[model samples]
Target: MISPVIPEDSRFESDPDEVLGDNHGLPAGWEVVPPDPADRFTVARLTHLLRAHERQGRGWAGSGVDDVLVEVSEHGLRTRENVVVRDPEGEIRAWGSVHDRSVGRMLFVHIVERGLDDDVAARCSDVLVEWAVGQAQAVGAARGLETQQIDTGAFQDDERQHAWLAGAGFERVRTWWQMTRPVTPEEAALAESPDHWEKDGVVFRLVRRSGSGLPDEDDLREVHEVLEGAFVDHFNSSEETFEEFLHRLREDPGHRWDHWWLAELTDGDAPQPVGALIGTVSESSSGPDGSYVSYLGVLEAARGRGVAKGLLATIISDAATRGRDRVGLEVDADSPTGAAGLYTSMGWTTKYVTESWHRDVRVSPA
Candidate 1:
C-alpha cells in the first residue's frame, strides 16, 4: 500500500520534520525534498525556473511571483504535493507538483532547468514523472478510485516537453488556443445597455455580493450548478463537489467576487440559472494588467440565446472600466460548440497554443 502525501496546516513556517516522497531514479548528485513555504530563497529560485521555462517554451514569460507562490503556499498544500530538486552544490534545478484536482484526476507539473545536458535533463524528467505515478496511485487509493488520470500540459512549440511527456507514457489529447483581445477605454460603453441584459427572454448580470463583499451563497451555488450542468458532456468533465469548487477557486491569487457573472432565463415563473462566467485579474510585470476568463459555461438549452456573448461583453466592459489593457482566455481548439468561432468573431486571436497530455495509472485494490 502507498501512503498519500499528508497535508500541512502550518502557514509560513518551516516544517523540517515533514515527510516527503522518496528520491528514486535521480542522478547521483541530485536530491529531492519538499519545498519550504517559509523560505524566500527557495521560492525565488522556483519563480526563476518557472519564468525561464515559460520563456523557453513560449517565447515569453507571463507568470508573476504571486502566481508561482500560490502553488506551494500553505492554502494550496491542502490538496497538492510539491518537491524541488537540488544539484550537488545545493542549487535548485527542477520543481514538480501534483494536485488532487478531483476524484480520479491528478494534475502534474514537471519543470526542469533549461540548458542542462540533454541526458541529465531527460533523467530529471524521468524522475519527476516516476514520482508522479506513485502520487497518482496514492491519491487514487485515498479517494477510493480504481484508476487515476494524470493530466499535464505543454506548449505547442515545446518539442522538449513533448518528448519528455511522451517518454513518460503521456499522450497528447487536446489542443487549446490561448487567445487575447486588446481592450480600449471606449469599450466601457459596452455595459451601458443596462445592469441586466435581457434577450430572447434570458437575463444576464453579475453575481450578487453582500454589503460585506462576500458573494451570496445561494447565487454562488446557482453559478456552480449551472457550470456543472453545462459541461456535463464536454471533454474531461469531472464531478467536483461544491465545497471543492469554492476552495479551489479561492486558492487562485487573482480571484475576485465581482469577476463572477451568471445568466438566467426569466421566461419561466422564476429565473433559472443557465450560464456562468468566472474572470480573474492577470497582473503584468511589464505592462498594464489584464482580465482572464477562467471559466465560461452556457447550458445547452441556452446555447443560441447569446448568454455567453453577454457574459463576455460584461467582462470586457468591466476590464475597460478598470483600465485593463487586454482580456485573455483559452478555448478548446476542437470544441463542437463552436466556441472558438465565437471568440474569433469577437476580436480574440490565438497568441499561442497549448496541448494537454494525459496518462492513466491503475491503483491496486486495497
Candidate 2:
C-alpha cells in the first residue's frame, strides 16, 4: 500500500485495531480520499466508476445518482463517510461506505471496477472492509453496543466479489430477488373485482391527506408503526426510529407524501392499521419512468387477511393512474413469510439476484 495522507478534516480516522492501510491500499499515484462536500463531485465520481462495472452485468441498478445525492444532502450522510479510490489519472476505481443502520447493525456498500484483475480488486476490497468494520465498531461503541454485524452484498453471478467477501470472514447469510413488473396506464386502470387483491376483513386505500393536500402526519406515523411491527420477524430486521424513518424517506427526491398507502384490518370492533406500503417515483437514464416500492409490511396477526395483497394492489393501481411504466420491489429469498413468492404471484418477475454476506464485529470500550 502506498503511503497516503488523511486530510485534516477527515471525519473519522482509521482505528489502530482495524489495521487499515495508511493510504487505503492506494497504488502508485492512486489515492483514497473523502468526498468533496460542496459539489456533486463525489456522487458523480462514484456513479461513473460503478456504472462501468454495471455495464458488465454484475452490479445493481441503484437508486439513480440524482436521488442518491439527495440523500446525502437531506439525510444524515456526510461526504467523509464514503471514500473514493482514484487512479493516478483521476479516474475512480472503487468506492465504499458504511451505513450505521442502528445499534448493533451496519450496512456495508463496496463496489470496485469490474474490469480490475482479481488481485487488484481483492486488495481494494480488503482495505475497504478494514475501514468499514472500524467504522461500525466505533459507532457500536458509542451506542453501548459491543457486538454488531456489518453486511455487504454482491450480485450472485459476481463470483469475484464473493471471493473477496468470503476472504474477509463474512458468511453468506441470505439472498434476495430484485423484482419488477411492467405496467401500462390501461392495465393499471383495469376495474378491480371485490374478491381480487382483497380479503374479507381488510380495507386498503391510499394514505389520507389533509385539507392542504399534504398527507396527515398521523397517517404517516401509522405507516411507521405498522412497518416496525410487521417486520419484527423478518430476516435481519431492527427497529428504526420514527424520525430516521421519516427523514430517510424524504431524502429521496422521488418521495412524495401521496405515494404512501395503508391497509386496515377490520375484523375487530375497531379498524386499525395492519399493513402499509410506501412507494417512490422511479427514473431511468432517459428521465422519470416508473414507481418503486420502498417498503411494504403486514403485521403477523393480519398476514392471512390479505392485508399485504391489498396494499400491493393499491400501489399497482396508483402507479398506473400516475402513468408509471413499471413497479419494482426487493424481497428476501429466505424470508419465512415467503415474500418473494407473493411478489411472483402478483406478476413481478425477478430482474436480478444478490447475495448478502455479514461479519460480526466486536468492539471494546473506547
Q: What TM-score does structure 2 among the candidates reach? A: 0.86
Question: Candidate 2 residues 141-251, lDDT tens each?
Answer: 766777878877877887777778888899999999889998877766442622124458677766777777767777888999999998877788887877657755776
Off by over 4 Å in 1: 1-23, 193-195
- For model 1, how does the per-residue alpha-carbon lDDT over 1-366 read when each residue is reduced to its tens digit? 112333343211122123234545567878877888789998899999999999999999877678777788876777887888788999999998888887778899999999998888898888778778877877787778899999999999999999999978999999999999999999887865424666677777888878877788888888889999999998898998887788788878889888888888898899989999999999877789999999999999888988888888888988998999899999999889899999999999999999999999998676
Reference-based TM-score of each model = 0.93, 0.86
Model 2, residue 357: what's the lDDT? 93
The true-structure Cα RMSD of candidate 2 reads 6.4
| Candidate 2 residue-wise lDDT at 123 | 77
lDDT of 1: 0.84
* Number of the top lDDT candidate: 1
Clash pairs, model 1 backbone = none
CA lDDT, every prediction? 0.84, 0.72
